[model samples]
Target: MTAVRFKPTLLAALMAASLFQSAWAVEPFVLKDIRVEGLQRADAGTVFASLPFRVGDTYTDDKGSAGLRALFATGLFKDVRIQVDGNVVVVVVEERPVISRVEFVGTKEFDKDVLVKALKDIGIGEGQPFDRALADRAEQELKRQYLTRSLYGVEVITTITPTERNRVNVTFTVTEGEVTKIKSIRITGNQAFSESTLISQMDLTKGGWLTWYTKSDQYARAKLNADLETIKAYYLNRGYLEFKIESAQVVISPDKQDISIAISVSEGPRYVVTGVRLEGEYLGKEEEFRKLVTIEPGEAYRADAVAATTKAFTDRFAAFGYAFARVDFRPELDRAKGQAVAVLVAQPQRRVYVRRVNVAGNSRTRDEVIRREFRQFEAAWYDGQKIKLSRDRVDRLGYFKAVDIETVEVPGTADQVDLTITVEEKPTGNLMLGAGFSSAEKFTLTASVKQDNVFGTGNYLGIDLNTSKYNRTIVVSTVDPYFTDDGVSRSYDLYYRTSRPLNTQGGDYKIVTPGGAVRFGVPFTEFDTVFFGAGVEQTSIKGDTGLPVSYRLYRDTFGETSLSVPLTVGWSRDARDSLIAPTRGRYQRLNLELGVAGDTRYLRGDYQFQQFIPLSNRFTLGLNTEVGYGKGLSGKPYPVFKNFYGGGLGTVRGFEQNSLGPLDIEGSYVGGNRRVNVNAELYVPFPGAGNDRTLRLFGYMDAGNVWGEKDSMSFSDVRASVGVGISWVSPVGPLKLSYGKPFRYQDQDKIQRLQFQIGTAF
Candidate 1:
């Protein structure tokens, strides 16, 4: 190669001449013809269109090089070349095989969607060219995801199908073999606590009746750390002073479904603290901080005590707005005697105050609702506890989907802070549409539209409509929370409904009712609330002919002038970390309804209590109890409209729907004089899985009965049944399927034998 220097005009002309000479050096192959080969999956026309130089085009070094690069970049070929013969450019290509089909075989654990997504993630998707490298990566990733769930020894095979247009279909036939279960757990170097006790601390459990559903038998590495923490806490609480997890090993069986966990623990010598010292300025209030410290001289060197002291100092600094304060413990260890001296160091920087609070992401809720919950106000010293409380308050509003608070320091200012609160709004409206099926009513559809917060103004409005063989309703309701300001939640609702209880044996009864209610909520504490409300109900009985003897008697006595004031008070506490997947929390609700001021009235009350408790990572226990009792006031029999009825899938699954009340004509329930129901359920997960407790096998025991007015509630009349069922939180709502066999039934009682219901909270 030679370098040429020339004037601007000469440079342009000389470059053109040099390019022509170089093109001619390549023999000026004037593509007299073109031939494409080795293209099994691609059309020849498409291949020719992709060529840089087509037929009859003079082949140049640059054009041929560009053609090869373009073909290679398309990823449709393993080899591509361009040959020139007397101006004839031949395009030669070895096309990559196309994928015609994808399939999975013997893969019971993971669904096809899961595998397809995994393959697509790695660029080995269906209908694309098949490359061995991509398939290998896909297989590896699948195995990794499976092994994470303790599924080992899984195999994947690729199957290719030759199809039309030189295209080929590929399938990944996978053999996801049996998942491994825990064989046994062996704990070493433990003397204080028994092996069984330690194993109980671990979420992984041995195979049992519940284990088949919970799959707690599989060993996970993450569970080891949690179990170690439990062991450390246990030993420390018992005065072990120093305990450590030395090593943990999980061995899987050859079948890949069985596993064994071995944990080694080191219980160090216990030490008593000789003394404690404080270093650094404690805001010039040494005495105050000295009193705040929980760790004292001559006390045991407990980790918990040390943590507590650190927290106390940190919180004290935070109270002064020094939220970034650092507290470190320089422990003086006496190795020879195994004793410890605690010296606390604190660095409380300049105090800062909140300058302004900004809220964002609340497109539905009014900004004031979030601002009212904030405790860290402008010009106030920053406090961690107050900020956390503010966050919790925003979360408790139930209007926001998410809430977050972040603090920022103002530039060039030592005592300035800015709080940014971000919140995401959730759908506060509840739309309910229900349909019921039974041997008596056949099928019924019910629907309602309600909004808890309307137009971000904290007002509620709703319309409800329902149609069924036994009942029909159409109502309009509205509520205004800002009626009086001061953060008082007030609600008012009005409604009109009609009911016609199914007459099983030659009876006809129907009633039309109109009512209205007003309620005000009183906030007791962060986790507790009380609501008070009053309502008026009027039920006009029509077509009471051929009705049950009890219903007929009620219509004749009350004459449809049943003006009543329904008084209700409710209390609830929700401490569950999550409304769903609550592993350690408690929720309780109690509702009481009392008839206070109503014509032809009596005193009546309905009570219900629900409790949810998490027994372990894989099990939860839920209990529900309800009782309804009503009687005629001033020696009048109870109104038939207020009478309670039971049975069916939502209640006792082994009994016919609404057949548990007092019998009237030939074994038909005339409506109960009093009602009681109690249900206890235990939910466990499916075997060998993650936290997807979506499908749970549950066992429930239900007991209670409805009785006549003279049949004072007694245990002798209580009917009981135990059943096993499956619960699924389906897309629509909660679905429960129960198969109960009644353990107690009278000779004339009708039983459902087995029942299942969907989309019901009960």
Candidate 2:
């Protein structure tokens, strides 16, 4: 009896052990139903969709674990669990708190919206899940931004407050301390060049009067790296073949208000070029390739020269439809003798054709407007020159802030490429209202509205109004660049002007001019245009006291008012590198006006030329000259209203406005029928601004004179002045301020030394 009982008990215990082992081993079972719980903001379907197992599907421990992981990976929940009860799967989750609002306090360095957007980029913003990790990352990002601006002493504190409905509000408290400025920069291990000279070549600098504008005193790692590269290049270009920057260190004061930088460099032995030879195919133009080489034997080795030579070769190859061309210079150095030999290697992989041209980032401008400026056509051989010229033409339109071009190889094709041109569009329309003070003009009010790309149709419209003590003028103008679709341009202009004597406060004695004109510009060449126009003008003299003698004589002979029909012809050629601030180029213009049928019959002509020469990377020399001649025809005297006036900001800076001319019996300027002016300027970067061209200091010399119909032009009688000026391209407009002293002037001459104006191009 005892043996039989023991056998039964042992069999039951074994069966129980087998059942427990099967439960832990993930035995598959058919799911009867699936349920999700604890969902507040998220929909039930969202949780159900993320589960790996569904109703009527097989369920196992693997599926349960996977479902839990999938739910948690969505980041919509803080905790997730999967429970199986008699083949029914239940999913339980605790949802994460959503951010209700984000706020900043005691933050004056940046706008609140800017900070919010920055945080949003990093997954920490309103309507996003609140997590401690995200908050910490956001705080670090804010601190990093402040560090870039030299605010090294900045601190940030984040606070999270719980609200109703599983939501929270976040606030960031910031402390922005005084900006740290660079105190000094020192260079060690430099025996070849002076420290001052090396520092001058860098953009970073010690604090100065212009530090607020230039911000060169701000400490930035990228700027320091760039300065180091500049130093390396400076040495490399001056025959230091093995120049290197060994190390750089930056130190901050305890107060975090001053920064000091030190750079160590090694200057290798100076090297001379012993020979330069070409080692690759030159399309049977060996002589041409040799001529293109800038590096010559017996001269000091220069990296710039080598780069230029390689670039020239590459461009030459691209001109022959070899778009995938490579040109490299291999320098063979002889350290013992300090001599080097350069070998240029060229490889023309394949000649490719442009399959298509794509334009982007011009939302406002029409595609055709940009397409018409391109010289390279689709399904044509790639011409680098044409592509570059097209980009330059688009830039010259002045419609976009930046234009970039890229070449992309077409996939699965060996001899095809696609050209992409991207442009950053700026506001083509400008509205300006300005006030300025000058010794001569005193206070002037000026307003203007201009649109270069009107409605994105490549048209121009403008209105100008000026109210000054001595002059008042209004002008309206419009231009259609593609009037006939063949690069012909048409323009219309209407103007009304009134002028008074500068010496008098009353506007009783004045001249009034009202005119309208229609012009057409015909493109004669790549850089040349001819303009022809016809206009009707009427000039009237008001009052008699303090009136110029020429005006009085004209009024007495031709009545108070004279009507004229004038026809004008002009030609212009511009090759300037930039429209706003040209470093090197030539600009020439010639205009002629003929009064064929009018009360005053006259012929007037003017020629002007401007040339800019880049003396170095930091200096530019500019020369300008203008000449005018007018004579009366058909026994009529030249209209005094048509005379040219000198001695102003645009002409002679040291003299009063329109005062360098013949005087009437009342000692008022009468202008002249002939005029000549010459100006020369040397432009240098503003102190502490490094190589920035926007703000510059210029020394200028000006000489000009105006001659009446009976007077003779003489160089000795010309008034001359020398002065210094500042040119700044501000956000509002271009501004000019000058202080002059007349070197050659008569006691009778009206002299105004200080001048300033806004919205005038340099």
Candidate 3:
């Protein structure tokens, strides 16, 4: 059979005789069978799906033209045409080359995977059809992404290489130029403040010694906008009632390596606040709402005060089940008198009930783990306070990196709402096996497997084994957070340990203690947990050559191998925003221990408190204090093994571990029965990281000491030091490194100015 090509010229000649459906010089005929050609990657089904005419149907030139247009519109083919032979129709298509791979060269600022994801979002990736237009779009998108990082001179060149099997490999070669730095920042229309002072209030700066770390010299549009907002807030807080940012202009230099920014602002006259008027329905608590007003009656107008008042009023209304409450601040101006009256109006909308509480974005975690933490229940009146509390509880669980509660209105219900809790899960455990060498421990092997959320259950399990010259240990632990329906927690610990400290110089003595414990945690309040536990242990003094005088004294008083049973009672409350890198919160712990029946009889108590205060977006203040006391029960003296040890990372800086306290005749730290410690630190954001809370720098002052049972506790006996440190919330865990300098210390004090540890800050 010979293929017949329907030429457009012949169709035009036929068009002169017939029109519309009968045009294009082709006589309509009943089609027999249709065939698709030139298909390599895409199947024949793709071509058949877009054809306008089917087999066994009357075919005309119009249907043939429409079918050709539909095939081209699919974007799967580069070319398409139709032909006829006898009563059969044929469709020919040139399929667009599929992308075999996407690669990048000379790109460093972002990972290759990030760029690949970006291109995939725009429908350009492996296995997708490729063409010139799509490649051009991908190039522009890469360039735009670089511009956000202040790389204005970045260039992207796409290279398409043909491969076998009708596919092409796309390579995006990126040439990232030098970052455009802010050469200068000029502020205009400042009447009451100097330009330098206003610039100091902003995060963006014109290059400084610290700018290399802060990257404040980099010119970013979003950063400039944020600076402008900061400047506006500065003015508004200082009584400039009509302050505004008129314009912000950013100019790039010819070389594209320097940028200049000019910000224009308008600051109006300062007005004094005359009085505050509250006009709102406060659910019969008008006086309470009035008390929330922070606007001073006679001071200069403060925009922050007015905002605080409105927010407080709104929150108070929400606490009363008014989910749609609104508070508006309307200032009554008196231009002539240079005085203004602050007026706050509140509206308590219809009280709504929570129809349902739903959790989303948690594919692995069980729903009960989150639901048990929620205080807001379904079918209850909407209380913003309860909902907020529920959100905080979930956040404190540390299972989710982000927790947000959204209030959504129920359709067709005037007074019904639903609470949606959205969460982003995080890896809650680690599996590690490694070897390390230290001067004290020599060569050691360590292995640990810890899982906080096992199989989507909110339970914790951990196993640890360490083989060190100084200390060898093996421990297995587990915790059931919800052992009972009432949120009671149960935990078990099994461990074996052997330690030999200060035994490096042919000293063979070591304290061998192996013990097991079971504990239960009972929640007394939302933020408070009371823990009680019991443990049985045997202490054996081994190797008689180099035992410390204190250890020998305890062994001589009791047998070399003595048994002890201890009971523990504890209470803790933690309200930290983040367990790894908290900027603001309060934590408290109280513990008491007593040896009920044993060769050693003693009672010990300890209390610790920590507080973190956020000074600003880039700074925080942390304070901590701890105290300990112990006494002998019955006629026995305080057990030397149970004495308090201090002067370490957890106690005082700039001193050797457990080096503070009464010294034995052997010139070793014997520890004490009483201890006190205090710490103060100022945390700052890391350079170039913006306001990231995970990495930070800090300056601290520490003071503490331990006193023996025979000595009295005195402030003069405390040792103190000042130091600077860096803290990073790394993927493995929280790490802190510090270098301290002791200002006041005894001649015998063992100084260790530098130290590093992995643990919580407080």
Tens digit per residue, CA lDDT, model 1, 734-758:
6667788889777666787667654
Which 10 consecutive residues of model 1 have the lowest summed lDDT?
A: 7-16
TM-score of each: 0.62, 0.92, 0.88
Give the Cα lDDT of each candidate.
0.74, 0.87, 0.84
Order of candidates by lDDT, top first?
2, 3, 1
Better of 1 and 2 by TM-score: 2
Query: Candidate 3: where is the Cα deviation over 4 Å?
Result: 1-31, 56-66, 83-88, 336-338, 432-447, 464-474, 499-506, 577-583, 613-620, 682-700, 721-747, 751-762
Whole-model lDDT, model 1: 0.74
Candidate 2 segments whose C-alpha is farther than 4 A from its true place:
1-26, 501-507, 577-582, 685-689, 730-732
* Top-scoring candidate (TM-score): 2
Q: Write the per-residue lDDT of candidate 2 for residues 1-762, one digit (tens) a residue.
A: 455443322343344335434664457999888877888998898898888778888987667656655676677887665666777777778888999999999999898888888899999988998878789999999999899889999999999999999999999999999999999899999998999999999999999998899899899999999999999989988899899999999999999999999999999899999999788888889898899989979989989999899988888888777888998888899999999999998897799999999999999999999999899999999998899889989988898999999999999999999999999999999998887655566778899999999999999999999988778999999999889879999999999999875543233688898999999999887778899999998988998666666677889999999999999999988888877888999999999999988797999999999999999878999999999999999999987777888897878889988899888766777688899999999999998798778999999999999998878778788999999999989876788889899998999998889888776575
Residue clash pairs of candidate 2 = none
lDDT of 3 by residue, 1-762 (tens): 998875433443344224433433468999999998899979898788888888889998778877766776678877666777888887877788999999999999998898999999888999999977788889989998898888999999999999999999999999998988889999999989999879877888887666666687887788888888888888888788888898898889999999999999889788899888878777889888888888998898888888888888877888888999999888888888878889888889789999999999998899999999998889988888888899988987888999999999999989999999999999999998876543224567889999999888999999999987757899999999999989999999988888765422347787788998889999998878899999998888887786788888888888788888889999988877777777899989999999888887899999999999999767999999999999988888887777788876878988887789998777766688999999998999776555656778999999999999889888778899999998888665677888899887999788989877653343
Q: Give the TM-score of candidate 2.
A: 0.92
Candidate 3, number of clashes = 3
Model 1, residue 32: C-alpha shift (Å): 25
Ranking by TM-score: 2, 3, 1
Which candidate has the top score in lDDT?
2
